[model samples]
Target: MLKNSMSVEFMAISDNERFARSVAAAFVIGLDPTMEEISEIKTAVSEAVTNAIIHGYNDTGRGRIVMEGTIYEDSVEFRISDEGVGISDIRRAREPLYTGKPEDERSGMGFTIMETFMDSVEVESEKNKGTSIIMTKTVKQVGK
Candidate 1:
């Protein structure tokens, strides 16, 4: 629960990915997010949620993803977390075109897309603890 910012918490489930994105989009829209910003935010959210479902949970459909959004005065932060197998190789996961499941047509572009969309993206995970993605984007004022 972030003070002075709007926050949303949602359970992580494969079927809830779209719902999470929609919630995030609605939150950003309340903050007067631009059309482009909304699109980017949605994409980033999708990537993070997908990663939580695929990589974190290994598509077992037995884990949960906790997503939170904080709207600050100058920026917005989105945190997506999951309790699952955790990331065994952070370096490899961050690498472009590196997919743990190549047969699924994953494209290995989750982190890449997140980085390109948001102003900053940070990942924290433990072998058995869980994984968390903190993504931030600075809002541009209209009449500055």
Candidate 2:
């Protein structure tokens, strides 16, 4: 069992999406997570960061994104926040295949993927106040 944490701030640009994932993966190095576990974390982080860049910032790429990761005894928790145009409807946004911009050809699977990969996912936002996504996953499999 290991415990560690790290947080980073970056411009909500498309390219930095990969950077966010990398940082998240790196932060869990102390746990020596399995490849599958690492991949899940990376994928969830990617989806969250992409949402912050796209839906949160409205594709303007002028907002700020804060990503934080913490490692517990057997689980990892991630929280990604953005101070951009918040989601007007939280329930609707969490629905699968629901994208605010269909014109952009988005699949609207961000929240779904995050929830599927992580053990838990929660979203909080106001109409104009900003949004935060918190996700957690157990890194160690049972009897492994």
Candidate 3:
């Protein structure tokens, strides 16, 4: 059962990426996740937030990033969203090492990393609309 839930929206700026990561970390702390789990969640949040700022907003650094979190009895779900240029091809984007912005030295591993660390990931987007990534992770061993 979901015990807690919250959502926050912030500017899609470079500096706010850190804030997003911190928010993700704090949201799941109640589950007493392992350090590694916490790190994985943070990294995933960073990647998602970075994409929203850089790709979603066309590198304009002007937009909004919404992060919603729900805490289950032994799991957590995060939904990151942006009101910017949506993804053209989510499948191609998830391919390993398939960066759309190679010129910018992007690794293009955002979706891959999120999928690797999280138990589930779902993306919904449309041209000129926006994108929302829903990710969930289960903590097999809940701390006391």
Best by lDDT: 3
Candidate 3 residue 104 C-alpha distance from true site, Å: 0.2
Ranking by TM-score: 3, 2, 1
Model 1: how far residue 19 lies from native, Å:
0.5
Worst 10 residues of 1 by lDDT: 1-10
Off by over 4 Å in 2: 141-144
TM-score, each model?
0.90, 0.94, 0.97
User: Lowest summed-lDDT stretch of 10 residues in model 3?
Assistant: 135-144
Candidate 2 lDDT, 1-144, residue by residue in tens: 447888899999999999999999888766778888889999999999999899989989798999988888888899999998889888899899999999999999989999999999999887667899999988774345
lDDT score at residue 126, model 2, on the 0-100 scale: 71
Candidate 1: what lDDT?
0.84
How accurate locally, in lDDT, is each candidate? Answer: 0.84, 0.89, 0.91
Candidate 1 residue-wise lDDT, 13-57, digit = tens: 667788888888888765677788888999999999999888888
Reference-based TM-score, model 2? 0.94
Per-residue lDDT of candidate 3, residues 74-98 (tens digit)? 9999999999999999899889899
Please estimate how well model 3 matches the true structure, expressed as its whole-model Cα lDDT: 0.91
| Candidate 2: residue 35 lDDT (0-100) | 85
